[model samples]
Target: MRIIEPVEITPALAVMEAFLVQPSAEPLVVQVGQAFQVASLLTNVPEADHPVWLSTKSYAVGDVVMLEHRNYEALVANTNKNPAGVGADPPNWLDLGPTNRWRMFDDKIGTQTTNPESIELTIAPGRAVDSLAFFGLDAASIYVRVVDPYQGIVYESSVSPVSTDGINDWYDYFFTPVEVNEDFVLLGVPAGSYGSIEINIAKPGGTARVGALILGKAAVLGEALYGTSVGITDYSRKDRDDFGNVVIVERGYSKRAEFDVIVQTSQVSQVQRLLSKYRAKPLVWIGEASYQSTILYGYYKEFNLVISGPTASDCSISVEGLI
Candidate 1:
């Protein structure tokens, strides 16, 4: 899986700039939106940034736009119809957002620890997020905390945690493109407070494995962001009224986005191993503007492959998003 790095912000004032420039024992300090600016700057970004969705005009391929809290792209290209209706057609539009719940996780930290029975991820986001989610965490009495450079520990989990096998009753089933069918839980932080977020997980037992992590405004993607991007066959419902009249309610979608992943037969195992790392956790799809917004959560819905006589050939796998 490709790692998405955070952006760098252009400090608004000289004092903040000096604080950032000078390495110190003190925690880094900055206001909100600055970290977002930095993250946006240090990347091979798009030449033409699309406008946030609008309804008054027409759109073409590669033209970015957002609607109803989701971003989208014109896949097949059409004019009058809205993006909400557009998502119903798999061949027409695509949704994009922070689908990868673990995008904020720094994989460089190494996902597990045994010597200390814990792992601390040093994150300097320069902003505050409402909640974060964890997937496939195998630990007993897991303790979590978020420390700010200036304020000490701002967020921490007091409730004793159950092992991964015992969490079916507590955690929600979050999806990740590479990883499929795993247990995950979302943690909420204090309200109206901001900080440079650093997550610390401590387990008393010998070994602890951190599967994946996601940080953002919404604790749950399926709730905060949910819509169909492709393979939506039907989205209509009907009910009978008191007088026997028909009533129809249009909800969201029967979402199932499918895509073929082609790889050589020799690399099949490698791809599978990488996919297994995610193990059914939500992934961020930053492929395009629209795809990033709507397909906030996805999984290895299904896959198929036919090896042709030991030589390098195409092995097809399909990705499915929130059902």
Candidate 2:
């Protein structure tokens, strides 16, 4: 297993342009065929368009407002009640998490940041980073490039993940349904002096959507052995009415996996420390890089490690993805 500890990207870290959209009271929607580039997204890097909370203005129930980097909805019609937990008699606002513009970095794979045609952005992480992991992608192609101020473009690669690539027979090609890869990783990214990472996303006809973008240094935990189990946790509701009719409410689902790996006893302490640090935090858990089912972006539910010999140990972990 390999884990990627992500680095949070703030407005100051973005060297080319701020990674925020212009804050407006009204909703801003990117039209079809519109280009979302870095030059157009440099203004007001910290705020969203949910209309900032005003102390003097009266708000009704269900009214949403943006405070700090998160969004909150009014639970009761009131004024002068701060969403930041100030002047709150009974907590009139409910936290809604990060705004739409910053949803890609929110670490939730269910929420997506979408754009028409393509979405491009550039950022400088300051420190050296060796890996990038993408989850919940809805695009045709992905282009990644790293640039250094003095060394220029150091590394560049493009990937197109589709199910059609494995179709070898004519019957399967004509009958099988086509699906795009939702999770991908670009490993072994060379670190440069003050490197700026650029990511370009493109879709064939619909909008380009990305759930999360993780940039960090990858640490190898252990070698994932065979017989790893993979499954999914579905959130859909199913019920039967009194009349014996079936009722179903479709909802999102998450991937899960059970990994059996062999780790060196010498590195057991380091592995335990790393897992304990990210116990509550979500990180990219890669079992086998070549298999899509082994790549999970979520938290571990349970793990157990036992010493089998002096030099080697066996470890078992169960991970559950975010819904």
In model 1, what is the error at residue 56, expressed in angstroms?
Answer: 62
Off by over 4 Å in 1: 1-116, 147-153, 163-182, 191-194, 219-323
lDDT tens per residue, model 1, 270-303:
6566556655654432222223222323455555
Per-residue lDDT of candidate 2, residues 23-84 (tens digit): 44124233344322321222123355589988999999999999776789999998988888
Candidate 2, residue 50: CA error in Å? 3.6
Using TM-score as the measure, which candidate wins?
2
- All candidates' lDDT scores? 0.42, 0.79
What is the C-alpha local distance difference test score of candidate 1? 0.42
TM-score of each: 0.32, 0.81
Inter-residue clash pairs, candidate 2: none
**Model 2 misplaced regions, further than 4 Å:** 10-48, 87-91
Minimum summed lDDT over a 10-residue window in model 2 is located at 35-44
